[model samples]
Target: MSMMKTILAAVAGAATALALAAAPAQAAPTAPHVRGTSTVPAYSYENAIRESVWVQTTLDGDLDGVPDKVAVDLVRPRETAAAHQRVPVVMEASPYYACCGRGNEGELKEYDANGTIAKEPLFYDNYFVPRGYAFVAVDLPGTNRSTGCEDVGGRNEVLGAKAVVDWLNGRARATYADGSAAVATRWTNGKVGMIGKSWDGSIANGVAATGVEGLETIVPIAGISSWYDYTRFNGVIRSPGYATFLSEYVSSRPEACTANLAELATGSGDDTGDLNAFWAERNYRPKASRVKASVFVVHGVNDTNVTTSQFAHWWSALRTPKKIWLAQQGHVDPFDFRRAAWVETLHRWFDFYLQGLRNGIDRAPQASVETAPGTWVDQRTWPAAGTRPVRVGLGNGDGVTGTLGGSSGNAKRTWTDNPDLFEAEATATPNTPVPGRVAFLSAPLRRDLRLSGIPTATLKVKVDRPTTELTARLVDYGTAARVNYQGPEEGITTLGTESCWGSSTAADDACYLDTAEDVVTDDHAVLTRGWQDAAHHVSLRFRTPLTPGRWYTIDVPLQATDQIVRTGHVLGLILQQSDNEYSTPSTMGATLSLDLAGSSLTLPVASGSLPPAGATAPQVKTAPAPATSSLRRPDLRQLP
Candidate 1:
């Protein structure tokens, strides 16, 4: 009996050991953790999985029978390949991937022999992939490997990018190049964040406005909120056929997009420069109420390419959790200007929203503004905390130089339009007489006057011609070192030394050249500028030509700004005609007569008050003004 019991025990013990060995090993934790306010690299960057897919959309932008397919290149931790771990996505849908390129270096996407992404432009993928997030670089429809016609910011462009987000959430379909279905259900957690600069960033703003279910957040840097505002200003065409031109510039196969390009030209309304259904469809600001994702807006105060109004309008309309960074640069990325801090802040933001980490970033200050060259300050909100509109009357003095003060003066000043004049020439010598423009100078400021928001110029005037162009500029007159935004490099000069942001591969290195702020000492700087057509003063949709010699009230909304007019500096407003750099010249040579008592400039002042009139303006010795260069819009065909 004892021998029988021992045999049974041995047999049962062997069976139990076999069952334990057959079971799968426990899965390792793939979620990253915060170590001292930063996400630890819990995953391997060098061994991350890389692949590509073609996401199908509902649009036939190229007039093809089948729907368009957007090319999506992906990089994620190896743990996500076998359905073992799921991660959030960081996506950038861009047209510049194969054409104009991206960032200050204009780095284009490079692929390996296997048609997989070997080198991704910028540092987003390198820095975020190891942090346990999947980075997706999508080629906009009609660009690169995507099959469709580029539509600029139209339905095809917006929806094509949105489909990738849908695929990750299992709401749409995608496939590999060999005709196999590419399903993301095994790898994604259904949470995504869109980020990019310029045209790429504009797509992000558009996608976020759609309120897509899986989208958690967006970071739009120097992005356009409204296509109409981007190419036109108050019924003035900044560039004729800009929509068509840009579409052709970025399209990989421009010949196939002829129909679409023609449609863009006709719908843009360049003849009248009026807002219509074409622009309405592309405008994202009106759809802000539908945005479910948190927004992190970054823009340059002196960005002439996209302009500051793009951010200002979008920022005011968003009702979701938001933050902003107002840089003192122009048409440049924050990564190049504020690299270290930008990477850290962006990491915290992604961790908080995508990783669901309680990092307290949501509880921090909402705004980071560059108050001076290379100087940044944090604020509770944009436009500062105590910003209030103050109206300063335009006083008629010598027709050449007028007085800007608190009390209105019943005087008339007149100036003729100069179609050939540039802004630098028109705004020079504010206290002295100048032809083809009228200047209004405020008494030297007693204290630092900080302008934190958009300014508006309301003028009651009579014009000699039925239609003409009008330009207004708010100038700060003081010798100081300021960000040279107007320079060719746009406030940054790349150095020879390189800095790495993350791990690297043989094909793609995680390094780039360093940069320094480009500052110039000048006597004065144009803080903000606005342009309009006298005929369309009544409305942007319709034009009612002005009746010669009849007084009409028109409001010109200037670009948004954040600047400090230091003590002893003079604030001047210059009114001119036909800024050839920004608008097509009217060349009508129309004379404009202003009614001083009815004209005023309303400014959103954050601190200090305008000094009383008759305070003698000081004549400071001026350094030779920084070399003024003709405004050259960045060439999308060859950005670098």
Candidate 2:
């Protein structure tokens, strides 16, 4: 079984016990323990209680400090023979909570004082002991059972992690459910690795940056590197999302939670727009530059919750040897099928980096899945440059196809910006299903058009309305054969970001990107209505590759409107008007110039198919078109 499955089961077992103990009167059960010399009093809890966990020092962690009561659970192994084996160590920090939120000083209490592990499902019996990895989940200083005050952006969390590493490497002993040595000091090899989703992922990155002795590898899933991108995207607040998240946790912590919900409810932690020292401290950019350990970066493309931009920031900034895996799904994709691949990939990485095992990780694929393709792409570097940047334009006309070089070819297409429909709120309308937005398409490839590059869309737009915004997306169309864009659609649903389920087959009614609601939170800070930067053109970019024999579509929708009804999926330069947050902007007085010639999306086209030897060019052939009619740029008005 994979380490992930084992860990999941272990955590589940612990959680189940906690769930059974929710009754008000019963004493929570004490975790089994192995007799060992303790620098501090043995941590005790009511044994008859249905669920309970406590922290007691097995060894003095800090010489200058008194033995601290550290929150922990001892999960024994299944056999004495297993106890002798050098088990791996998995260390993690919990999310920022009331007592645990950065800078708050409070003991790590049972989540909700329920004492049930189920409530904290991330850590259960299904997760660690069975995998032969000792799982140590710490509440950063000043939270739950641990001493010290919370320092949200402080070094205490990383320092505490290092201290635990030292203690675990020594003569510490842990007892499993069956009273076996799940972790004995003898089993430690002075090696440790960290794994966490979201906040835990951030902690892992922070600890790795410390270059703590014995630390080996890290798998950060959907973790943030730049606080700027998380709380604000492109300098705009994703609003209630980031603000709500902050408020929820701050309320949990009594010290920092000092503010009334009303106070906390006021979104925007700070009002400054510039990058200052305070924000810098909270940002992980500096730490990313210092990471030396091998890292496995996993994130979802359509994740508006944390925003994929943060991942992109870290992936671009990290100085360490790293491999990034895009799940083409949502934030929780790592917990699904990706988990199996992650376990295999991570084991090889750790073995190669930490254990000196030649598991061929050095030769493993660098860029993994691109949503629709559903397969891993092995490359020496990311954004593998080379695929030529292609540009095409948008034109008007009927349902019938219009030839590219027709005598009646028009240079520009115009749409009205109705003032009645356009407003600051227009941007939100497109987040859901809008009638349509402007789209641009390239001529069908004469030769197999191989692309793997960054895409950019720019529109020379003039709006009569002062407040409005635009959203653009690049989509791949299956022309010659079957293709699936629903990979993203279904992936997000699995991650619990949306309620929509998509069909695997290409059915117009069943398969479509979810535009029914604006998943992009205000905190995400994408372009917003009333805040359109006239000097700076609005565009959307993400690292995604398109396959051959497929027609890719780019959707640029104007959002926030109050007039006109729009519906259905329409192909071509289509424009629909609506009041949805994700819909197209309403027309007040607007003249838009979609400068297709100037805007280009570059893709890395591989030379010889058999893995690129360094950086060589792919063989190219300008084959004739397949007796096909010329491709035409669709109009904007006739869209869904």
Candidate 3:
């Protein structure tokens, strides 16, 4: 009887153990939560996973025998691995991470003792990682720890970035620092969105133009669409050896990239300022048709560095889902201009594109333009709806002041190229004669005139020099407060006080200095300017040197613009030679003659017509020079 009772107890104990083993293991913590249109922070940011990998590319940009390896630093929610959940990626592939730095405060990446990333430069990881997203910071080949030579915007740079997207989608290979395979297939959902400013943003533009898979969207702020446009404007070189200089500036080992630098200098075609196969390879506009990802473009109307033409040409070519924000500032990020709103909008954009959120962001207004200082208006399309080109002829008068619209005979005006004269001086005293430049003014507007889109200047001119540089400027003559884009602080002044954007840690903080628009009152502001070389007047691909005193007709397409000319303000066109700020100076004392009857300024007028030529002209005022400070310029080059 005792043995039988013991057997029953043993059987019961075995049955209880089997029942416990059969029960399911506790479920891992749930992924991030979604409230309305945004991904809420349901995971701990401080405890997020941080690691680095080297992605192999199919390029030997440094002339090495093997393919190059691009360094990728990443921060992701720990829940992704803990719960075995996959997340999308938000990436910024940049050359500025270890050199010029990034954002308004010039933050650089910081790494911990374990050779992994400890802190990223921007608020991306701090804000998005906790929301169940992975933030990847990739160093372009030849920059930082990446193994290759910087090729500017060549195949090396563009393909290197695309390889990261390929790796995220399990199409390319990546490895840890110790050479062990590092696979993202287990953690990634295969969706990627790229975002950055300046050169970093330019890479995003290039990568998206490749039509790479898994790239869902891109936010390119002041990105260059064409390398030719960045280095040259209408067949005129902006800076000689600029490509080589930039490559060396961002390279981790400049000595190893000597051949690459030489190739860039030669391929840039600065000597001829003509588009070639080299520049063609770097031009992304022609490849826009291949882009499958949506694009969110942010550009400063007053950004003289990258200029408005970069975004203008690229935006016009895109047929994919797209949106734009034309800011009033210079070369600056939207975060510094409109922090709270930018963050919220960017959050929605990422949530929609990356997380597959069915939020209505894709259905939102297609364009948001800063019509005036601190004023932004949403529109269904850019160019402000009813925009059409209106051709207004230039009437002959004194070499200084002429009528902008009216029947004009064969009167001619002449101005000599003065390399020493700056645009400020050339555009000043419009009603009075200015040496080295000729000006034509329209009667004060009866109502506010909104000029949208690009303006083209058709000029019949004669130049004595074989190759003379021509400059055309659309100027607004009035006294009003406008964004100080040309001032030392490029439209925003950084304050001492700081504001935090997300959760923080000892190594990485979300806090940054506050900024405000830097506004200044000026009598005249140069709205848009275009530069061209007479030698390449016919085509940007070739040059046709002019015969001495020979007549030629050229179309100078001014930079894209959207500006409102207030009533009582005069609209003026200044024709000159050698824009000292943007182009190489023409031969000193090269005389230029303009046939006024044959010349006209074609404007994309969105509202109001120009006053009759016989109407009264507004009195011109001479305002003091705009204020200047010692603030750093946003252009990669340092101020004098």
Candidate 4:
């Protein structure tokens, strides 16, 4: 690849260059409060200009022996570029530059007749640009105006986006289309913060993992930290062709990226669904440990798309300063659910971290979690720091009733892996069992209990076949009003009129169509779900085939959650062989024998006074799988 070994002289802005030449090296300026508060009244939105810059990357993404280009669309207060005052930056790098769009209404970046982008989706640019912050929207490599191939979340994705932070901090270069050097981003301060949802948010996580200088913080909402986890669950293919499918959706000219797309397909390990070096290179957890930036994670607990564990695992690995927002919605944005509160919290977050202002953000609550419909609480830490994991064993009962005990004698129950069984059907009847599935219930709790961490199902079972997959769900069985945050959009309807977070502009208006209220209804809600391939019990990278009659004990981690089961509501641990919501059914159809003595669901239940000595957790009869509760959830993978 051709390297533009230019002197750093040009990379530094005229203002910074002149200062360096005129004076000896001095200490950098102290962190200052650029804006008084995060309130909208602190600044105006109309004086910002929408612009674009093409940054150069070190990776030859197109394999053309030339570094690729990253298109950076920026919106900043006009005076900032004029050298009136310095402002920190906020960026969102995305693969969905034009295809399918972003957010619920699917808004794409609109361009004027002259080729300059006119409007951007969501309100980041519209609202934050005027609030003493520069909002940058970047088109990831191989997409939109960027030149090269899409590597999904591989090294290319990390380096290409990392180059932007380097450029802002005067460590990288950029050029215009005609090969002329572009203007250095010298007007504003070099601090940069990244944020986005889904793929866009994943970019933030990837870049932050690089520990790149100038990347001060990241706000990854419903983002993926491990590409392998995104498509596979413990060695079983949760969704085949996910990389290829997403590649097709984000890019229009597939022919140009054919080689890159081919690599993704080949490296996915569709045949065995095993993790290899390819996936190891894409995992951000290891990289995140070295991060120099702070983190602000927002995710939906019921999100099956990226899943809740994606956020929890990543959050747990991060040693940097961090914050979290655990919503009750599935693959949904908090903007639609919390609105004004989200903006205020995010504004304060940016002000404190990026602008280096003491806005009480760090001193404020570390988590704002939604427990149920319209119910939320703040805490000092996610999962409240001292959560105790309790193992409630499978107890005595008719195969259909849930009898959870501390140590029930060994009992056997059998069910074949039924992939077609609907989640609604599994929790529908209170005393019946659905075909191909078995339900274990718990007696109504005398006192309310809360779950605040990952729930693991330890199952001792014998498989009749070489390999099989099991799906475990920690569900609430009582009829209570809960948020219908099952699928995309989180049951919020799009409205007619536009609501402006700030004053509007004719071309780039600060207003967007408001969202309707959440659909809160009285029904059974699936708190969280987890899946595991029986063959991958020992390791996700290797398969250990099950011996016909030999029993194996496996721990399958269920999706993490932060909700409380109200008093009188029974908790159900439903076990199934297949889940149509994420993957296809396997035909081996081996029966699984559950040895209750060794099987128990380990849950991070809230601490409270025990019921009493000798009081077993109790048992309850279960409803048959809802023959058609599919209506309750929208299509999986449907973007919000």
* Top lDDT hit: 3
Q: Tens-digit lDDT track for model 3 on 1-640?
A: 9999999999999999999899998975544556656789888888888999999999998887989999999998887689788999999999988997888888999899889999899999988988889999999999999999878888899999999999999999999989899999889999999999988889999999899999999999999999888888888877777888888788997888888988987888877889999999989999999999999999999998888999999999999999999988989999999899999999999999998778899899999989889999999998889999999999765434787886567789887787766677767777776678888889888999999899999999998889788889999998888999988778999999999888798999999999999999988899999988888888889989899888999899899999998998999898888765676643456899999888899999998989887532344767533332322222333210
Q: What is the lDDT of residue 555 in candidate 2?
A: 31
TM-score, one value per model:
0.92, 0.55, 0.93, 0.90
Give all candidates' CA lDDT scores. 0.86, 0.41, 0.87, 0.77
C-alpha RMSD values across all candidates: 6.2, 18.6, 7.3, 8.5
lDDT comparison, 1 vs 2, better candidate: 1
Supply candidate 2's per-residue lDDT for 84. Answer: 52
- For 393-480, candidate 4 gives per-residue lDDT tens digits of 7774654554665435656888776656677776666456577666666776677787898999999889898888888888776777
- Candidate 4 at residue 218, lDDT? 95
Give the per-residue lDDT digits (tens) of candidate 1, residues 238-308: 87768888888789978778888889989998888888999998999999999999999999999988899
* Residue 38, model 3: Cα distance from true site in angstroms: 2.2
Model 1 residue 494 distance off true place after TM-score fit, in angstroms: 0.7
Could you give candidate 2's per-residue lDDT for residues 1-640 as a string of tens digits?
Answer: 6999999999999898888776467654322221121111121111111222333343332222554334443332334223354545665665443334321012232332434321222322223344344445666554554554334433544555556665566634333334444333555566677777676677677777766667778887877665544553333333433433443443224453333333323323434233445455557666666676778888765454555556665677777678877654544535443444554566466556644555577776676744232445556665453434434333322212211211223334335433333222222222222222433322323333333433333344433333233344433222211111123443433233322111111111111122211122121111112222231222311112223222223333222111100111111222322322322232224433333322332222432111111111111112232221332322221100
Q: After superposition, how far is residue 397 of candidate 3 from its true place, in Å?
A: 4.0
Question: By summed lDDT, which 10 consecutive residues of candidate 3 come out lowest?
Answer: 631-640
